[model samples]
Target: MKFQQVYFVVDDSFRLLWIGGEWDESALANGGSDARSNEVLSTSLLSHITDEPTRRATQAMAEAVQDTQTALRIDYRCDSPTLKRRYLMTIQPMKDNRVLFVHDLRDAQTFPVTFSQWRHQPGADALKCSFCCSVSLPDTDWTPPEVLAGPHPDVVDFTLCPDCEARITEAVSALRDGRKPGVSTTSGYGPEGTAS
Candidate 1:
């Protein structure tokens, strides 16, 4: 599956100078025609980012670009109602301006499913089960990594989620007790193996 990307040019002050790319225009349009026009006309880069932490991070990157006049890249996630997406944003400083490239990384059907199949793609993050190498879905359930294995496995990284971590702990306990491993605590039993 193909991912969307957007590009923009901004001055040192972070004001939009030029905006191009299919995704860029589409994103602006998604905000409504008035907002899109305003963005193209005079909006600041940080204005588009609703999340405070992401805005701060982007602000820092802009400041760093102004100081060093060097190119840099960062990753951030955007959780909009229409788009729960991750992006890799690259900033390249020109003589008096900077160019930003935003690459989208949200292809669920084709995402890498296994750790071996996974590659460190620069933008998105995922929750993984440390013991089983299964990934957590947005619904807070886990699935084997191989279920999402895309053509580029090496681009994504995974972290352990709480439910899977608990499952792993229970499995280890069952092994130590020489008993057949059972379902998770959430479903199987209470503290002393009483029905939950």
Candidate 2:
């Protein structure tokens, strides 16, 4: 069975369309899907959360597309309402219909996730590891990427993971006792080159 994804449309009236992901089967087939009512939505308001960004994006796109005839090509970005990562959204006006596509900006945006999220999302990132003091996202804090396809701010942050934190502590303790980290023994010596 298929479920409808939500979409906003501009017609005589502002409408919300739940043209579910799948159209052939399996859903609350109660009525037609032009969710055009002033009543509160029954489902989560994810899109609404990104209303500001979406509006700004659409405005900018509309301005650019005003000159285009028969079709409009617009590329914008926002968040997932649930996830604060970058999303690349494209809207195209077809002859008989309108289309929109949204994608995650992981590869597009170098640093899509937040420092806290990077630390906590079930991985060995900043959260699990205590040594990682930060994640350097360019342009956010230090340097932003040269040209961004999406609206991802460059951010550089450090989160201390556990092991690294322990190492730092140990190093500090050793320093208190007049000891340095350690010496490198292999001065170009390995399995093949066994000497200086």
Candidate 3:
């Protein structure tokens, strides 16, 4: 049940006080040549997040955690030239006016109950991806909905994110054109399914 994860302690002002977990120094570096852990210390945790919408959401969550003195969870996506991934972040308020942040990377698709559907469903608390086990976002192109909209969770509609939808479209087009659908060599889905 081990997944790619990272954790850090942040002051009420969102300053990163400490960081540790499964993430390596390279993964923790914020696009800097100096990937040393010491360099990451004292930096604002939100500074490492490049997405505007996600960063704003994270800020709101941090504020709420501090105000209510309770824990909160949020799902977000991050992508850079070196990495593209989704994570679930949990924020817990500490007695010392600091917040503990836990980040769990989504690596595998979990079935049975999709995270998106569970949120709107009654009595469910766990959030997870519906199909690909990747984190789910509403408006983002990289991570799209896998289920169709419906009142019944059992009959939920499944939809792929824009990137995945595009990959499927390209593969289908290749088949229609009577050629083999290319396989991507890199981690991302490239044009015509070939490596970028």
Candidate 4:
């Protein structure tokens, strides 16, 4: 299987400048036909991110890169209905106050059974982490969507779980403190935010 890569550049002010490397193909494959390069160019990077927590974390990461002039790396999952795809995202500071984001596919797995595509509606009872693909019911701990039994929620909210939020914060803080942050893609957090 060929692992695909996608990259985009943004000015210091977070305006989209350029995008390349399988971006259009990935978008089309991931049900993002409207996210083509022609349509997204010259827009705010935050505008493309629909999840509120995700937008905040992305802005923080970009700002941290600009402040420290250091690159930050994080691993995330962007799974489709039948495929589990892992990617490493590198946020690199560039000259002329530009930041380059490169996403490298690290792994892909085909699920034994296909899942129906989920819809994300604001204020939904079910919450899903945008980074980890974990799902949580109301007043419950996060659980991997793979292990979930039948009858998944038709509408779920996209947000970060506590563990993901902490990990992202740590990674950004390390950059701010002039330390290199390690990459973590591990999911499945327990009730207390411990890796299960």
Best of the candidates, TM-score: 4
Let me know the TM-score candidate 2 reaches against the reference structure. Answer: 0.28
Cα lDDT tens digits, model 2, 1-196, are 1112323332212123333332222111111123333432333222332223223333434333232312232111222212322222223343323333222132122334332222122222112111112222333332122223333322212233234344444433443444443311111112231111
Better of 3 and 4 by TM-score: 4
Model 3 per-residue lDDT tens digits across residues 1-196: 2357778898977888987885453223222223445776897877765334335545665666676676665443432222344555567889778989887665334433333222222223222222122333334223323342422232222222344344434543443455544331212222341222
Model 3: CA > 4 A from native: 25-34, 76-86, 109-196
Write candidate 4's Cα lDDT for 50-88 as tens digits: 688988998899899998899888877777777777777
Give one digit per residue, the lDDT tens place, for model 1 in 133-169: 3455455456544345332233333343455345544
Q: After superposition, how far is residue 175 of candidate 4 from its true place, in Å?
A: 0.6
lDDT of 2: 0.27
Model number with the top lDDT: 4
Query: 1 or 2: which has the higher TM-score?
Result: 1
TM-scores for all candidates: the values are 0.44, 0.28, 0.47, 0.89
Model 3 lDDT-worst window of ten: 150-159
All models, RMSD in angstroms: 17.8, 21.6, 18.6, 4.7
Descending-TM-score candidate ranking: 4, 3, 1, 2
Which stretch of 10 consecutive residues in model 2 shows the poorest summed lDDT? 23-32
For model 1, state the Cα shift of residue 134 in Å: 17
Task: Return the lDDT, model 3, position 28.
Answer: 33
